[model samples]
Target: MSHEQIQSCIEECLRCVQACNHCFDACLQEEHVAMMRECIRLDRECADLCAFAAQAMSLNSSYAKELCRLCADVCEACGNECKKHEHDHCQRCAEACFICAMACRAVAA
Candidate 1:
């Protein structure tokens, strides 16, 4: 990967991680936290996926595309979940997830 690509991936990954963490925290605060279990689960998964994608891009690994695909999917899922909540944190997290998803798609493309 080029230096620019690595930098881009790092930024996306950091954003994703923050979003996921925020979503998880917001989920716990939801009135229906039980219904948000899947959301929280996917939030954690998305965070991990983003981290892996960033590492792959930085290392210029052949698996970067596959990792990017996974990252995109998880970000989409997390965004959908966050959209169901009206909390400011959830709204912010959803936006972050959307941005990361777009970044992942660009890298995958």
Candidate 2:
């Protein structure tokens, strides 16, 4: 895909990476840390994938579409996990993840 076509997805991926990272750190500081294990783990995974997907798109990699497809799946999983929690960070992360998933899906299609 052209750079222009992939720009929005790239932006969304970067936003997701930031949100996931923030949520991961915030989750660790919660009073009930044990309850946030899955969310934290998913946050890390989602952030990593989103960052990689953004990089792949920025570089115009041949596998950008595939990477984005996988990123979308991870984002959805992370969003679902985040939605389980009541913290502000988790809620924000969920919003970002869902938006990122949609952007990735559009690009992958």
Which candidate leads in TM-score? 2
The local lDDT score (0 to 100) that residue 67 gets in candidate 1 is 86
**Candidate 2 regions off by >4 Å?**
none
CA lDDT of 96 in candidate 1?
Answer: 89
- The residue-level lDDT of candidate 2 at 47 comes to 100
Question: How many Å off is the CA of 74 in candidate 1?
Answer: 1.1
Q: In lDDT terms, how accurate is model 2?
A: 0.96
Clashes within 3 Å, all models in order: 0, 0
CA lDDT of every candidate? 0.83, 0.96
Q: Write the per-residue lDDT of candidate 2 for residues 1-109, one digit (tens) a residue.
A: 5566599999999999999999999999999999999999999999999999999998989899999999999999999999999999999999999999999999999
Backbone clash total for model 2 is 0
Q: For candidate 1, list the clashing residue pairs, or say none.
A: none
Range of the 10 consecutive residues with the lowest summed lDDT in candidate 2: 1-10
TM-score on alpha carbons, each prediction: 0.87, 0.96
Instruction: Give per-residue CA lDDT, model 1, range 1-109, as digits (tens).
Output: 4567657867977888987887787788889888888788888888888888888887879998888878898899889988887878778888888888888887777
